[model samples]
Target: MAGLYVYSVLVVLLLTCGAVMATKENDQIIKENNCETKMGLPCFLEAFTSIFETGSISNKCYVELVVLGKVCRSALVKRTLENPLFKDLRPATIIAKSIQTWNNCLALIDSPSPSA
Candidate 1:
């Protein structure tokens, strides 16, 4: 019984440590890359919704997201998935959505605009 209890405690501690390290890494990436300033709060929320839920992002917001870059976008999504509020969400599905959204925005930005 004591061994089982110790084992459970160790598991919890390892999980907690892993979460903290992931959070710290995400924060470091956000700070070092000036991710927050890259996109407005409204656009950030739009992008989040677009990736995590069945919401659409505006063209303006798409531009903002594209400018935010893959590293910042990926880290933000990973960090959000770590939140307790998002505990029920599947990380793999959400991550795939994030990548799709980023790719779409990148394509939109990279392609030449149609002539007037």
Candidate 2:
């Protein structure tokens, strides 16, 4: 009966571990999907770490904006707005632009716009 008891414990532990892993995966998927839906881009830091880390298109664009002192957050917001895929994003274009201006101003106190 000792063998049976050990086997039962092993089975229970395995099942518990499996359940935990499944839950973690589900949570990650939900987070990634939420980020994608809101941003109109893949979940770079979450679902597509390799792409982001390796400087894929979106990642490269983000880095460029940051380096240019262009307010990365506004650039991301503009990207989401300009893309037809994220048409359902909230606050309207006017509000989005206002927010972008605020973000840019908050970050870029020196020159505002180099190209302007």
Candidate 3:
């Protein structure tokens, strides 16, 4: 019984440490990419929900997301997937969708505007 308790505590400690390390890494990525400042709160939430849930991103938010850049976008998705709340989600499916979203946004940004 005591051994089981110790094992449980160790497991908790390990999980906490891993989460902290991941958060720090995420912070560094965010800072380097200027993610927080580049994407406003509303747009960030829109992009996040669009990725993790069945939702669509608005063109305005898409612009913000594309400007936020692929590195920041990928890192944010990876960080969210690591959260316990997303444990049931299939990482590969979500990751594929993320890439698709990025590609779509990039295409929109790259396309020439209609001649006025």
Q: Which pairs clash in model 3?
A: none
lDDT of 1 by residue, 22-75 (tens): 999998999999988999999999998899998988989999998898999988
TM-score of 3: 0.75
Candidate 2 has its poorest 10 consecutive residues by lDDT at 46-55
Which parts of model 3 have CA positions greater than 4 angstroms off? 1-23
In Å, residue 23's CA in model 2 sits off its true spot by 0.3
Best-to-worst order by TM-score is: 1, 3, 2
Which scores higher on lDDT, 2 or 3?
3
Backbone clash tally for model 2?
0
Per-candidate local distance difference test: 0.93, 0.45, 0.88
Query: What lDDT does model 2 reach?
Result: 0.45
Candidate topping TM-score? 1
Q: What is the lDDT of residue 96 in candidate 1?
A: 94
